[model samples]
Target: MKICAIRAFTPLTAALGLTLLLLSFGPASSSTGWLLAQDEAPMRGDKKVLTIDDYAKWRSVGQTSISPDGRWVTYAYSRREVDDSLFIKEIDGGDPAVVVRGSNPEFSKDSRWVAYYINPPEQEDGGGRGMREAGTMPTDLHA
Candidate 1:
């Protein structure tokens, strides 16, 4: 009688353990699905796709520094495949001027002057070789 009782209990215990294991590792519940559905909904209706021309005309602005007296702002701007230009403008309002052709513009402590680095133009070997073969190298450092 005791053996019969033990045998019947064993199969029940095995089924309960398997069910618990599956529940722990199975896919997430319906609440997770509802949250994901909310996130997938669009926030706006009037968005337009961007085109290549829009990208071509875009100017990327880089590091900016303000003058010590708060009178001038200096920044670097560049377009794709173009040399970077350092621009300086008056805070009150005026056309920005190209101070130099370089990157990483900095303002002096007294805001009297701006400084930056300019890479020297590449040199050709005069052998009518392509860029990969000519190996033009930067020759000078400018500020």
Candidate 2:
């Protein structure tokens, strides 16, 4: 499995982790085809970012990213329900914990800030009218 980012460059589709348009990278001595799917991260000093085996560990729909210091990983778990609810798990030395839930989860560049989408569910009224649910911030986790 080659490490490549999704190269469609389009919003493409909204199918859980399939929505990701990642940048793929290749090693030296490779000069055949154009880089597809995703682009490679530009880094120096002979440090490899991630390997194919690591990426295979998690399911595709959920997005995963290595921490800046490479200590922990923050990713979304997208198969909680039939509707594909999201969950953020902080994997460290021990068990991972649920950090948040929703769609399109992301972390800020500094890794201090984070963002996600909140598709509020519609509420039904006794009168048969329905309304979309409002977005709310997480109340039960550290930020």
Candidate 3:
């Protein structure tokens, strides 16, 4: 049990350590998680596969919208921009072409209609004249 007797590691041990270190750093996926690894490691064992609904985009930066059937999802690919307002990706195929570009997008309750706004929010504002010709503001000061 002499602490001083523990000499340096052998070359074989050093090689084994290096190999393991490289392997762990290369690619690995947890058995239960939404993240995917770069490698094709069958680490899931007997666990079931997952879909887009199981994960959420950046909580603060982006928003998530799930379809009624939970088979599809739409989220902001990047910042809500004029060219790419929102993107709709299937849980299975989930191709990029399924994206909807415009101001505000709307999905039907039954996951039927997927409409993208044609105009901006500012333009859509109902800021027209009132029903009757109203006068100045309520000038009756706090009584």
Candidate 4:
């Protein structure tokens, strides 16, 4: 009876060990799914093949902040290697104008004001300057 029990337990233990071994290596095999998808075409009809120049011309928007009333939005827009600019737009529909040469835009709690930090350009003396040091920081807040 003892020998019969040992034979049953041995097969069960081996199967459990094999399952754990396969699970341990699961992530490495599953990561290849992304590689398989890379060769597939995009799901848009009007999409064209992207090139390096297209990336350079790409305008990226970042870190959008909406007003409390939901009527306005402030965000940063930038081109490749170019200066980032802050912009505010009405949600109802209006042209977005550049508020300042800055990023990380924020809106006031009252939804009446927008603010952003102006990053100083590199100085010729290889030093950095703050907004005050650069003189006349342009802010969207009036008052």
Candidate 5:
């Protein structure tokens, strides 16, 4: 009896196969009916189509840090068309302290304080044509 060896497709192969499959449809202008149909079809289960207006609500997080005592955490959240904010929260339970237009948080050695950069307000002149600079440090570190 002879046995055949089976081979599994890697991600690259799968992507290439999909690309070839799509390319087989010929020019997009002439063969995009099926793709357009999928977009135009009514979604089931109360699903709604996404629009450009929803992009402003999207947010991203970066530069996370935890205090040495493991009781606190700091992170930065940024949104499109809006200012970024830094948040310092107690791990166990407490309301978080929010710093508007802040990023890159760091905990002090004793875990009693935090340091972060404060971004300058956005400039409206020519929609910010010039290059923006880094955030400035706070002169007063007191709470």
Candidate 6:
């Protein structure tokens, strides 16, 4: 009787184990089917992976400021191997003003204008290089 019972359960146990193994390695949808909608599945074909070339062309926004009247927004846009710019845009509508090589923008007290620093063009003279290591000061320092 014991041998017969063991023989009867051997095939059933094997089938159950096989089923569990297949479920463990099945598609991700099988596990997350309840959380995701049927129409909201990932569009894998439309996506493109980012590469190193994409990073080089990327632009980023820096510090931002709002006008006193809350009518305008100013922010710095910077990119690699290109001059940075300050963008001043009207809050409600219209095109934004672009200031090349500008940074640290501040709106006027009356909100009539914006003030910012225009960075000097980069020179190949290696200005400010080795200031700490060589203990040399730049002669053209501005207050």
Per-candidate total of colliding backbone pairs: 0, 16, 1, 0, 0, 0
TM-score of each: 0.47, 0.35, 0.33, 0.50, 0.56, 0.53
Off by over 4 Å in 3: 1-61, 79-83, 98-101, 118-143
Model 2 agreement with the true structure over 27-135: per-residue lDDT tens digits: 3212222222122434467743545533332223455543333333445543222233444434334334443335555554454434556555433543532343333
In the range 6-49, model 6's lDDT, one tens digit per residue, is 24456444643343233233232233221211223344676545
In Å, residue 9's CA in model 6 sits off its true spot by 64
For candidate 3, lDDT tens digit of each residue in 1-143?
11122146865445433432332231223222222323332337665444443333211113344445544444443322223345454544423333333323445566655545432233235563223221111111121
Better of 1 and 3 by lDDT: 1
Instruction: Find the candidate with the highest lDDT and give its number.
Output: 5
Tens-digit lDDT track for model 5 on 34-56?
22112333357776464665545
User: What is the C-alpha local distance difference test score of candidate 2?
Assistant: 0.38
lDDT of 4: 0.49
Model 6 segments more than 4 A misplaced: 1-46, 124-143
**Residue pairs clashing, model 5:** none
Off by over 4 Å in 2: 1-61, 94-101, 122-143
- Candidate 3: residue pairs that collide: 90-94
List where candidate 1 sits over 4 angstroms from the true fold. Answer: 1-45, 52-54, 121-143
Candidate 2 residue 73 Cα shift, in angstroms, is 2.4
Q: How accurate locally, in lDDT, is each candidate?
A: 0.45, 0.38, 0.37, 0.49, 0.54, 0.51
TM-score of 2: 0.35
Off-target runs (Cα >4 Å) in candidate 5 are 1-47, 127-143
